[model samples]
Target chain A: MRAVAALCLVIGLAVPALGWAQEDKPAEFPEKLEIGISTDEIAISSDFRGADLTIFGAIEGYDPSLLAQSKYDIVVALEGPKDNNTVRVKERIFGIWVNRRSMTFELVPESYSLSSTRDVETIAAPPVLNGVGVGIQHIRLSPVGYLGDGSNLTEFRDAFRRLKESGGFYQRDPGGVQFISASLFKATVKLPANVPNGTHVVRAHLFRDGVFIAEKALPLRVMKTGIEQMISNAAYNQSFAYGAFSVMLAVLTGWLASVVFRKD
Target chain B: MNIFIILGMGAAVGFLSGMFGVGGGFLITPLLIFYNIPPVVAVATGANQVVASSISGALSHFRRGTLDVKLGTVLLVGGLAGATVGIWIFSLLRSLGQLDLVISLLYVVLLGTVGTLMLLESIRALRRAAANQPVSLRRPGQHNWVHRLPLKMRFKKSKIYLSVIPVVGLGFGIGILTSIMGVGGGFIMVPAMIYLLRIPTNVVVGTSLFQIIFVTAYTTVVQATTNYSVDIVLAFILMVAGVIGAQYGVRVGQKLRGEQLRALLALLVLAVGARLAVDLVVTPEDIYSIVSEGVYR
Candidate 1:
């Protein structure tokens, strides 16, 4: 009887030890993502062309096992400040092209860039990606008092994406994100010179086995610097003063040129 | 944006501006648009550049003692009123997504008519000169309906005692075209002063430019306040090149006769007009256009 008791006690201790190990799995993969940009602010001056932003990040407690099944899928997306943006499709009417029907998507990004480790389709299911707003299709395009029975909604949305994409406002670079190590990753986002001046949001998402594991957001600012800033503020804020200034400057320049060049 | 291309284009525009005593906006706008600059920005910024160029020409005229300030003031009143309407039309068409179409149509018509008229008139003058036929200044000595109009005023410098109604009407008409074309209306204004208002050619350029400064200034303010489409940087760049080009143009223009100069200017205008016409008639590469609020600025 004593021998049997000893075996029972040993077995009980081993089972809990194994159970505790299983419970520690969540702790191993911390649900935290930390990201930082190479620069906090991008200044657009007179000669502003497109610029590149380096985003480096470290994932908390990344497991090698996640890669055994498939390479870790990391998607980084940049969204401009939310505003009501209109999208229209042109149809040939009477041998001339004119805008037909239109749709407005509230909270649309002026510019969107997407980068992933592999093809987005290979990383996760459509529902999972869409739910988490990972792909272009997943973007929340809340219609602003949309007309019709929402039957042709997809058509308008697709046109919006197509237009933005053509203008370099929207981009999809599958190879944009590269992993340096198991727990570290980096991405480079190229901003066109015409990128709107405003606050932009950058999101980093991690997925494993078609399941979202972690997500984080980092805010970025795109702004005009030096004279560009001054002029922009004058026009938008003190509009009357700015207008007066422009006229005064033009008149002064004209008069000055005449005075300087007048011969006899 | 290729800086070299912009500078080169600026120099060419500046030369033409200085030679013809024009603002060069008509030429600059199309090139800028071709280089992928947004149309609104192109138009507004072109206006800003015109103000500077016109002011220079006007100041020279003022120094030469050819400018008629009294007549200019009358035109200024009409121009300001017309500019307000022009800006409103610019914005209305923009929202309707038809500004590009309207701007093109206006350019084709204005340039075509003016260019053809100038060309034919210059050819006639050249033939008269070649035949050694003394060119007589044509004037109507008899009183006509134009003189019968109300609010008659004396423009001593232009040597015409005419009603302010026609002068103001002419100003108002040119003002509308100025805003739409992003020009100082020099091409139209000079001829209008000579033929329509019967102002002497000696002082017409100065008077027209004087009025243009005010007209474009008003346009600049309105566009800046309402549309916020002007790019100061772009304007500054173009201005630098324009100033230099104008200097060279003045030197070259000194060697040409009036008819020869008019014929060349007519040809240049016709070329630009024809290019715009082709774009309108030809099917575009992409029927669908994409613009956003951000690009509007």
Candidate 2:
């Protein structure tokens, strides 16, 4: 009985220690990967059935070279989980440029896939630059130039339309991944007025040879304003409610002060 | 304008709101209008700045133990309800497509009347003070009707006996107006507390601020969720400047006599009123439509 009790105690402690030990082991990347994007969440899974490698872990950090390097392959596939469950994927061998100040992404590459999904719209691939191979698709990525040269309203509108058409811009949609083709340009995505005020997930993925090598998800939060726009409309647009209230208060106070202190 | 310029304007309005007890709506809305921002967007954005400035002021007042929790709570409860109703009314008007013209006309009339009244009152006070006449005092029996109302209660700060029903009714009414008008409602509440409730001047400021904090905070949360109008970045920048300015204003406010402060505030109101009056008579440079595509639209 004493031996059995000692054995049970040893097993109990050993089980937890074994768990700790296993947890300390480093993770490995899988050979094949499937990435999914939904309205609320993002999921990345490795294809164990077809691959020998294992995904050890996922890390996210600022990479300035992401927009410039073309030696490795990077592809982003967006699969919707609701309703139609449509799948759209884009693959490219590109360099990356990171705007550290503005947290922007720019992709530069000698070639890029114009259409990765069967049904989704695609942009016409730009011609490859000199010295780069002429065969595949080439896209220049510059965050600053992605928008345009000027802050004029027309320029801004055109830039927005182009970015939407290019399928390489960061936009708040039902779901999608932002990819870049060249490191030559830079742009900023201004938050639209219609965006819901709440927390959102921003995922950055690194791919090579049609598979994700690394993926990272960051958290973004939106906050509230204290007054309703309708109230403002009523006050400023409809009736000087703020001014009227101020005057009423001033008059009441002035009258009361005169009466109480007998100053008038 | 550029992002930096927008941010700078927000900071400037926030500082002014902190320095003066008045809400920055008068300044911010006009400035935005002048800059060609739609009235709705201007009001919404200005409210965002007001929340920041009021928060900074409220926190300091709370720290000083000047805030009256009970009074503020009553006011907030009524105010929030009223604001909801006001928003509904505003939407109704908007759907009818007459919101802008109505609002502008109201602004003109209200400002003109208020400004003229204040100027005249201040002059009268000055003349009376110079004549060495005895100041008017409230008759002991004057507030008998207030006592007759249901839910009678005593507010120690204001040191007057009044019914809770009147207080709440006044709060709700003012709240509705405030929500409809997009004003802080501080101006209304201060007077109600002083004359109707007979609260003392010292307690009035703190109590009004307490109620404003709750009302504005609610406004911010609701506006953000429903309309996504709140910009955290903008609010943060304005609050930093506003809090610093508020501290200085409070010190300066403490040194001035109540009569002097009232007179100055009256003059400021009148000046703003006159400006609005002029805007009413003179045709707007741009009388374009105020509609825009956004979540609300």
Candidate 3:
């Protein structure tokens, strides 16, 4: 009977822990979600600290009604390991939620519907950080709204340049090509220093008017290289030590209080 | 070795919080940065830990019949409104990408001014005490501008006759600063209560903590839901330790001479202020990118 009681007590405590563990898993992806990051593996040189990230993902299935009413926004985040679990810390580097008309594209020349024209709204530039070196830089490209008929490439490039000048998108080289066909578009940008090391997510959204038409999220891994990795690992692993330090301080404070306030 | 150092740092912060009645962000933020934690994470985590400490401390004070609920409520109402406006302002600056420089400059100026004032006042108080004279503390005059304001009210604990407008205005200002800086604003609130509102010393301690509880709690929840900035696990651990430490601190506080305590606190504040001032004047190690991305974007 004693052993059984002890066993029951242990089981009760374990139940909540198990439940929490299960709940900690990443949120389940929607059934038709299509996600992909710009790169699978990023290599950093000893001199390398951070880089600009381009996240591109697409979504296919859409309900026209949902796309017409709700304001659609996509959030890309970075998650890292903490105490044996992954935790999300940063938020959307690329937010694609704007009025649908501003982002909409048109198929030019009704008979030549073989290619669609997309007005790629300006991409926002990633945040710049100071010394200590290393972190993720992000650039996002997403369609603004449902494409209509008669969209032109010149109009698309104008919009893209507008975004760049407005400081929402990264400033590309003067002769840089901004327009790409959906089938053969591939571009790689370098990452800079001050980028954080972690698992990063990139997201995209298709909006109509002000409503969301489709959304996609993708993950990219950013790891430390050479000396930086060792430093980061050492720093992160200090949490347990900090916890223990706090407890000791509590004990000391309690003892001090007892001594000082004691009635002589 | 790393574990020991981290624990030591945590204990140091807990002790300072207990002794000074501060939320410990002034200490914790620099330490987190020293440990190479990202600036955003440091601020968010510090705010989270503050919630736990304030909540636990507030409950204990409430049980002791020291908390002035009516005053706390009014302050909280104003604080909430101020926080909302402050958050909006922060978002606007962020969208403009000018938030980092602004916040950094603000921190340097605010901390230096407050710290200097505290140090000077404590020195004056100490000198008076040393001469074996009863300190002649200045009382707010009846003809003072604050009293001239409309809609005056009475606070039984603080035993002051002051206008609700001033109280609310003070709360609103403090709330906005707290929200923007991720600070509890106790360092500012306590002084405001004692000097401006003319609240008694004993009442100020409990009342300030009372107001902080609500303000920090609201900040924690808002940041969690909107920004997803609160780290519950890290906060819980610090708070649990803080609670026990605060309990003992209160006991110790009761025994210490008030003047001496003030002097010690003044010295500590001045030290922190000097360090922050240096940071502003000296070229920073890194000057770009103080704002972090969150769900708000």
Pick by DockQ: which candidate is best?
A: 1
Tens-digit lDDT track of model 2 for B1-297: 455665566556554454557666555555555566555455445555555455544554566667767777777778788767766665565444444444554555555555566557667777778898777876433564666787766666456556777777766776665544545667667776777766666667777766665555555544444444444443444444444554455556667654555566667655655665455455434222222223232
Instruction: Give all candidate RMSDs, comma-separated.
Output: 9.9, 18.2, 17.6
The TM-score of predicted model 1 comes to 0.81
Task: Say which candidate scores most in lDDT.
Answer: 1
TM per prediction: 0.81, 0.48, 0.52
Query: Once superposed on the true structure, which residue ranges of model 1 sit more than 4 Å away at CA?
Result: A1-74, A89-102, A142-145, A149-153, A173-196, A206-214, A223-245, B21-23, B140-142, B153-161, B198-203
lDDT of 3 by residue, A1-264 (tens): 010000001111222222331232233422122334535556554566444444333333334454344322233223221111111112212331111122322211000000011222322112311110011222222233535563643444354434333432222221121123221121223233433455543333333332323334344555556754553343345434433333333334434443443443
Rank order (by DockQ, best first):
1, 3, 2
Better structure of 1 and 3 per TM-score:
1
**Candidate 1 chain A — worst ten consecutive residues by lDDT sum?**
A1-10
Could you list the iRMS of every candidate? 2.4, 18.1, 12.6
lDDT of 2 by residue, A118-198 (tens): 111121122311112111122222343335443443332333324433433223221122233231111112233332334
lDDT of 1: 0.75
Candidates 1 and 3, the one with greater DockQ: 1
lDDT of 2 at A225: 35
Ranking by TM-score: 1, 3, 2
Calculate DockQ per candidate and list them. Answer: 0.35, 0.02, 0.03
Better of 2 and 3 by lDDT: 3
Q: Rank by lDDT, descending?
A: 1, 3, 2
